[model samples]
Target: MLGRQQDEHVRLDHAVIGGNDLSEIDDAFDSLGMEPTYAGKLENDINHLSQLGFEDGSYFELTATLEPGQESPWWDVHMQKDAGPTAWAVEVTNIASVVDEIAERGTPVDGPNEFGRERPDGTYFEYELATLGTKEFGTQLPFLIEDHTPRSNRVSTPTPSVADTELVGVGAVVVGLGDLDDGIEVYRQAFDLPEPSRQTDEEFGAELAHFPDTPIVLATPLAAGNWLADRLETFDDGPCAYLLRSSDWDRTTERFSLTGESSWFDDRLAWIDSERLDEINVNLGVLSP
Candidate 1:
């Protein structure tokens, strides 16, 4: 009977994509009809840029290491292996409570550490974060982010033209797990997340767990020769794709067509290949009014 309580403070914030080339990454997103804003340097080592703001308050961050061969934990852990979407962040209303909850569950927590980024206009945005679980979890468990400044100032609203397709928000993030039961237990103990609605998909030979009141779905491959199995082998059990919501599916498909990129879509949603998206899989679904 695990369910989301009203007091639960965590919500999806943003997902991070890492690359060595900034301009190339920016151009790729631009072709997707997204307007990116450069947020200047983060902690003085990583260059931060973000995509258009979504109604759900979730966005995408594209980052690149500014200092080559620098000993940066964020870059080394997330971006060192490949240039792709690697980590995600969650907004927490009360970080101390979250940290204490994790510690009570016998998981070693890292910071309550303060960090900030500057805008080109010279305004500074500050926040504190706490990391849950060990390095073994990698990008599977999102770090808790507590913002010190106004969220609007940190992420601007998107102004899309009538011809442009609107990216409404993130529907869910698809994460590949090493063990489905163990991953579920870890999330339940660490974050107190709601119980998931479970299903077995024969098409993919995977078990899917959709969490209540959250945009996270854990997938574990049940057999070989499936997309989940391929992702598990390639990314090694972590976030592999994001399910994005769009206001107009037709316009979004046309937008992808204009870029001369190959995409696959049905009546309900569209899938953009990772080769066109800086190695990140984007599944676009229609957003409800």
Candidate 2:
């Protein structure tokens, strides 16, 4: 429901997480039982984005800011935080064309500029990007267009074996917003979605909504400056949760050593990633929308 794309209009391309080091994050997930598949890397005059492939063809890109003297559009402004889920990448027929259509709707976007590297086989590689607006929580996902066709030899799909900690797909995303109702309305209107339902326990004012099957849940912090509220407060809102799933929960948890670090756990509701990303547990909470 989020992007206004029909089932065939755009393909779920990549779920990107912005961080300082791609290999470190990959290694952490690998140690967590995920058989990480190496995608390619990109380096311009400024930043870099590295992708990790899943068996199902979808992948996650880890983006990072280049050191001083070099600047990237995303890093200088959006990535000021130590690290976070910066954007999601979706691919359509043409990145620029989709940008035009999305822009017509008045969605804030960035260039779908050409970028690439020289390959070992004497071939050149390139791709384009058109960033969709960031969520009210500052989560920015883009529509990526690879330069090559699906049949090209560059695109390889590995038969992935179920890792102990394999994230099947994004289950639910919990966001923190300043104006809860307005934030929900923003997503609802953007994706042509419906109103959300309320589910609160002793702790939070949880309002959950869905997009077809994708669930987007929202929660109000117990205190104004709570951890979730503090860092993400500036964006008018920001991502508070990462709902991840796996083939084997025990194996996945074991691989990541989550049990050692997680402050909380619910066999079904939420679980923490042991290798902490910042102070947050890299929470795997909720389920598909």
Candidate 3:
């Protein structure tokens, strides 16, 4: 059995972006100049996924239901509403030890459930996943993952275009909540994170904070009827955006057509123009590392 350490053992794995059409989501990423690798369909045949893989084994999992009106165990409302960042998972070295630690810290855990899938090339890979609480669709708390098969089999290498961009991996996940303090408390308790630095962004119309070195960002609406509030009403308090970390910030930005530049605390941030990502509600961001 693999042993585990504390929070240092956790790292950003992948953000699950759900949509109504899987193929359309693929085209959406392709339009952004990132090639999506088709992973495969779920065993239930209710969902399929394609991934935007990165250098550090992190990815953006673009997924959608295979059939309409069919309830998927993954998510119902988010998938129906084309919620971009519906859920997220962090990679851990030891599944059992981490689950035990979280449970001891007073958070409810549902698994280290054994899960696997077959790829298009007839290769198969498996992993263990555990929910932090009740297996709700858009829970603020992230799920945990550890690989049973070789991790490379599950996460593909980046294509040449993506490789040249120098994107390291997912840097942070932005979650929208009704109350920022409540969300912070939950994350702090679950992950043993320290008090985070806070700031309010007038341009984005939300007050956000980062949990030290972790990939979690908690945000709440600055006022009623703002974009964040609207997203909360639709997808509730779960992942709303994903920001990638780049090894070479200038090269990554020049490679893609970014709509505008922004800031995350002290780090420089840029956004992919939404117009380029047709039929996908996901907002993709890149941050200086």
Candidate 4:
């Protein structure tokens, strides 16, 4: 039903990837060929942030804790576990209206809470946040953001190093679930996404469901000892992978020293080895055009 709406209510804002150290996060992504810009510390004083911006304005937000043993409302456990792509955000207009709509759909919605981070330049990046499903933050459901400052001020303009590359922006967020049916229902209730197309990847060892045309894919382990199962054991049900869009499929492959390749529904994608970017521990890849 949401897909039929005339005015778009939601769009991918950024993917939240947590790490133990900011310098390590920057170094890991730099080696991956997409350098991240340091966004400075949060007003809460718990974490420092960086942004890997893309042409579409969406980004991969690398978050690192400042105070060890201090609690971060959403990403404390994720940072502690070194969970890479732990949470995600969607941008929306009329935050109050969107919150009401999602609540009316039988999903619990929390806060248009004010949050901010100070940029290195001493200017502030202010925004409002609302989360869906649970308070834990990595709900496989997204938290919503509406910027008080210009969003351009919050997101780094693309640097020439990555701007010339084929990578576009975040195309899909792969959520690792314990149960496929339960995950599907959670997404359905939160956003009212239509029935998704389902499949299984023997190599990935998971069952997949792709919500049509959206940047959401739900994955559940096919058996014990699989990667998804291991991720769930530590990180629970939340984003496990983030695939960026590419303008040219072939150029994307040749541009980076890729670890392996795979398909997301019909689209082709290639990933960088996690070992290569061990500092960040992120499962990052690029999707073909």
Q: What is the TM-score of each candidate against the true structure?
A: 0.79, 0.69, 0.93, 0.92
Q: Candidate 3 residues 7-103, lDDT tens each?
A: 5545777789987888888887787678798888888889888888777677888888887556777778888888878898888889899989889
Better of 1 and 4 by lDDT: 4
* lDDT tens digits, residue span 1-289, model 1: 1111223454677777666555556666676656577766766555555455566577777766665334445646445444366677778877888788789988778988887777778887888888777743237787888888987767764434212346666655667787899989878877677787887655435687866666677879888757667656666666766666666666666655422222112113345543557443433323222
Once model 3 is optimally superposed onto the true structure by TM-score, how far is the C-alpha of residue 32 displaced, in angstroms? 1.6
Q: Which stretch of 10 consecutive residues in model 2 shows the poorest summed lDDT? A: 258-267
Quickly count the clashes in candidate 4: 0
Query: In model 1, which residue pairs have backbone atoms overlapping below 3 Å?
Result: none
RMSD of each: 4.9, 5.3, 3.5, 2.8
lDDT of each: 0.63, 0.49, 0.79, 0.78
lDDT of 4 by residue, 103-195 (tens): 999988889898777689877778899989963674568888899998877886575557867777788888889989988998888887889
Q: What is the TM-score (0 to 1) of candidate 2?
A: 0.69
Regions of candidate 4 where Cα sits further than 4 Å from its true position: 1-7, 67-70
